[model samples]
Target: MKPLHARYPFMAGAREAVQEASVDLAEVVATDEDVVERALERVEWALTDGTVGDTRRQTRVELLSYPVARVIVSTVDEHICTRKYAQAEAASAHERFVEELETETELRSTRQQHLSLDALLAEFDLGTAVRETGDGFRVTVGTYLELAADQWGDEWRLVNRSLVDGEVPVDREELYVLLKQAIRHRVVDGLPLSVPDVIAENLDEEVERVRETLSNMDLTTEIDTVVPDLFPPCMKHLLDQVQKGEHLAHHSRFAIAAFLTNIGMTTDEIVQLFEVNPGFGEEMTRYQVDHIRGDTSPTQYSAPACATMQSYGDCVNKDDICEDEINESHPMSYYEHRVEEADDDELTDWREGAGEDGDDDSDESPD
Candidate 1:
């Protein structure tokens, strides 16, 4: 990647400004300058924040994300006290910001990046923005409010009326809080990071060289009971497919059932997942799922290796996570490595606000 100054010129431009103290009204008669420039305090805070590092951080990339996060929410955005910008200008600015994000050299490598919001909302299943304004785009708030009211009652509806009507002004500090969250999210997601085209060709060549080696990574006897929180990318893909009622290849089905079985799912639950398919046969599906769970075999069947999964065209999201973790030949090895990391105090919560035990994991103590 090019230097940060080159990639994000806007961030490079947030230089220190000239500082001068303001005159205090009450103290003006008593003292020449009783006022302090709070800007100086902000500058100091930024400096302190920019330099502080968690010595326990696993990678330098994670440390780098801190400053990038600050830049995304602070250096790059212009704060308006009110929704006073022109609609056309806001749209233009939004477009430019997206282009910058799309081109970010470091984004793809950082981790939680997803399709840009516009791209995601472009699909009708997600629904189109009901009303567009200079301030922001919003989905059909009526539908949301109806659902909220149904779940929480009429008081929830009353509270959301201001939000739907734009009567309640957005608290500026709260906006900053949300902005920081969004910037932090993009950083953690590894948005927009991709290999340079020149290097991408080299990666393809290199991956091809090691592709054959993957076939031998299959596992037979050594299987670990990995928790769902630590499932490898390919396994997660299969789980998602089944949940969506998509057709799974034979190997994919076996791998998924074996995995769910290992993680404590019963034969009936596995069979139920397949019942959504057209022309579903409950008896046949039950038998097949039970067979994979090893009811028919002397020993339990284990999930396939990454190489075998690759042969099934299932290893599409490989970020070389295995190589980064332990260079494990099998997917189970990756799962075990994640489980170890997930046990650590500083690294355990991979899913936002979710605990290893499948409960809400709040940083705060309950009152």
Candidate 2:
């Protein structure tokens, strides 16, 4: 098996490599212990660490494990699990590609086969769409829209970028970011594949383990009650920025929106919260908030974990409650903890007075 395929098993070339090798996927899963073990590691590490775990030394094993891992994930058949696996795989590939790009030209060649930036772009048919200028690159508006995720932050939004003609300017770092999203889209495109009965039966144990891990990681919080005062520091910070008509990064917006959605705020209420923002557009705001609430999207996301919040520089003003790693590792968990500790008298139901002042203002007759 090619080392390049092992490094980027999501690439179409890698699938072609496997097909050319005439590898029998079902037979590999049933008979190859190393491949099966590596496959299990791929899924498990993805769940636990947001990585597929390194197995670079065993090229064939690593390459074969990817398909086996897909089998196991498909057999498990959980959307969240599937999403996490795809994300982790995409992330690992992004890191490797970035490292290769940063390597000196002479040194990169000496290294085992690796796809150059131009080659990688060509592989995805982005050659014409992403053109390098003297200072940076300008991506075609069409390609930019297809790859840029609003979830990355405000910077990725078309309105927030410099548009020249029909192209949007992006620096090297931004191009890499788009490529990562491209990899993720490719990886997740045909996911939850239809597994043959033999392969599914062979992977039953791995499937069960993945399910168990998913259960533990399921961040779904059922908070039918609304108490804004109990919001975690990160959520509070994001919400404050929104109410003050300050610009919020996309990740921050997502963190707060997901946290609120999980904590019983309807899409309308959430949209109202952001109406004061300078960049607010009623339709887009409603659509984004609805997307986060899963009213208009396929995936229902929970508030990011504390680590993720910190990663995007969204985590701020950690109080004593947040300092406790045991209980407050996630914004939703922190909110849940605070709600549990709060007495009824100390909690204000934000829902009770929500939009009432606006309603009153509307009802007032013009004198």
Each model's lDDT: 0.40, 0.78
- What does candidate 1's lDDT look like per residue over 1-367, in tens digits? 1233222212212111101123222232123111112212222222233322222122223222223322222221221100011111122223434554456567645644333434323322324423335764443444333222212222223232345452222232322222223332332233223323442332332233222322232322212232454678888888777767687777777787776666445666456445556544678667766776678876677767777888888775776666674645677668655653442233322222222112233212121
Tens-digit lDDT string for candidate 2 (255-329): 887887887677776776677677777787778778977778898877789989888998899999998886568
Off by over 4 Å in 2: 221-367
Q: All candidates' TM-scores?
A: 0.32, 0.64
Cα lDDT of candidate 2 equals 0.78
* Span of ten consecutive residues with least summed lDDT in model 1: 79-88
Q: After superposition, how far is residue 285 of candidate 1 from its true place, in Å?
A: 3.8
Local error of candidate 2 at 192, Å? Answer: 0.9
